[model samples]
Target: MVATKGGDRVSGMIVETEAYRGPEDRASHAYGGRRTRRTETMYGIGGTAYVYFVYGMYYQFNVVTAVPEVPHAVLIRALQPVEGVELMRACRPGRPDVSLANGPGKLCTALAIDRSLDRADLLGDRVWIERGDRPVSAASIARGSRIGIAYAGEWARKPWRFWLKGNPFVSRRDGMPRHVRAGRKAGGGA
Candidate 1:
């Protein structure tokens, strides 16, 4: 959940995520320890928001994971609206409810996420994640490659993307048949 610029709260259940391992993952902004003004937040402690602008158009939201300096983060890909649905609709007018937060950019727009919230403490009042009302079983999660990183070479094929199986709100299908198994942890927000 996150508070908007107007102080209204918008919340959703995360249904899709993509993990980016630092230094090693070619798709990661922190790859090869390339620290800059924008990617510095990825080096922060876990639970920090590493929001960034991409393609000069959209702001993508990520949750820093692991201990400090790890630079591991999870990109929030899709969300299932749980609160402030009407307000979300107002922010993204004319879109169907299922499409409101079905992608990273759309999720950020629906929740009013932007660079201003970069490095924000997710555990703080402005933004925070909560346990979903119901548990998601391992068998219900599909694992596949991250999207829109074809230039990452071999790293583009890594099965770092996870989403709820058969969920209508998922932004796009990854075309993988594998499912997460019990006891296997999906790093950075499974």
Candidate 2:
């Protein structure tokens, strides 16, 4: 859940995530230990928000996940709208609730997240993560290669993307196999 100063509140259950490890991971903004104004927040203490603008348009939101000085974070790839559906629809006019936040940029747009909230504390009132009811078991989670980063070379093939298997709210389902969607091995499916 995140609340903007304008009093707009959006809440959702995170259904997809992508992990990036700093310095060593080519897919990370902090790769090679590069420290820039934009990536500084990623090196901060865990629980900080690392929001950045991409392609001169969309803002991507990430949660700093490592202790201070170690840049590890998870990109919020997709979310299941739980509250503020109308507000989300307003932000993404014409989009159905299921597709409103089914991607990183869409998630930000739906929740009104932007560079203004970069470095904000995730435990603060303005933007925070609240515990939600357990919606899926760990075994139901599926791992896959991160998306849209083929330029990262071999690093792009790493299975760092995690999402709830069979969740319609996940960003993309094209590559997931039917058995995985069914929460079973290929041969185990009835």
Candidate 3:
């Protein structure tokens, strides 16, 4: 959930995520221990937000998952609306509910996330993950290659992307295993 400066709260179910292991992962900004002004936040303790701008547009939101200096982060790829749907709609006019936060960039737009939120603590009131009513089962979690990182060579093929099986909100469905696509589970459930 995210509470804006205006006091409107927006929340979602994290339907998709992609892990970027640091140092050895070529696709990671912190690969080879390289650090810069933009990547400083990633070195913080776990639960820190590593928000960054990409492609001259779009701010991508990531959760720093590693201990200090390790730099591992998970990119929040898609979310299913859980609260403040109307506010999200206004932020992303013309999009249907399902499309509102189906990608990293769109997720940021719908949730009003940006570089301004960089290094924010996920445990803070401004942004925090809530426990959903129903827990997702491990059997229903599907893994695949990270998207849009073909430049990472062999590292791009890592099965780091994880999403609920058969979730429409997942950014890309084509690479999912055939068995997962054929499963009976659907959105918001395992």
Candidate 4:
């Protein structure tokens, strides 16, 4: 969940994620050990937010992972809305709840996340990850190639994307495994 300065709150279940290992992963913004002002937060300790703008418009949200200096982060690719659906609908009007936060940029827009959230502490009350009671079995997780980075060559093919199996809120459902798609068709549990 994330609370904005105006006190409006938006909450969701993180259903999709993509990993980026700085200095090693070509698709990462901090690739090749490059450390610019924009990527500095990515080098911070784990639990730090690394929000960045992309394509001159959309904001993509990521959480710094691993330890400091490692620059590892997990991109929050998709989210399932849990609270403040009306606020989210206002932000992204005309879209269904499932499609509101189904993509990285869409997730940010739905939650009002922008550059202002950069370097924000994910462990803080303003923007924290709460523990959910839902149990996710290892077998219920699916992995696939990261999206929108074919320029990274072989790195683009690495299966670094992970999502809950049969999750309707997952971004790019067409890219999911055959079994997952079948499960969704059969109305299997997410």
> Candidate 2 or 4, higher lDDT?
2
- lDDT at 11 for candidate 3? 83
Candidate 4 total steric clashes: 0
Model 1 residue 63 CA deviation (Å) reads: 0.2
Q: How close is candidate 2 to the true structure, as a TM-score?
A: 0.89
Which numbered prediction scores highest in lDDT against the true structure? 1
lDDT of 3 by residue, 1-190 (tens): 4546368789888999999998899999988988999988888899989999999979899999989989899999999887888999999999989999999999899999988899999988777787888989999898888888989999999999998888887776745443455356677334
Q: Clashes per prediction?
A: 0, 0, 0, 0
State, as a TM-score between 0 and 1, how close model 1 is to the true structure: 0.89
- Clashing pairs for model 4 are none
Candidates' C-alpha lDDT: 0.88, 0.88, 0.87, 0.86
Write the candidate numbers in order of decreasing lDDT: 1, 2, 3, 4
Q: Write the per-residue lDDT of candidate 2 for residues 58-169, one digit (tens) a residue.
A: 9999999999999999999999998888888999999988899999999999988999889999878778987878657789899999988888989999999999888899
Model 4, span 34-88: residue lDDT tens:
8999999988999989999999999999989979899999999998998888888
Taking all chains together, each candidate's TM-score versus the true structure is 0.89, 0.89, 0.89, 0.89
Q: Which RMSD values do the candidates have, in order?
A: 7.9, 5.2, 6.3, 5.7
Q: lDDT, candidate 2, residue 65?
A: 95
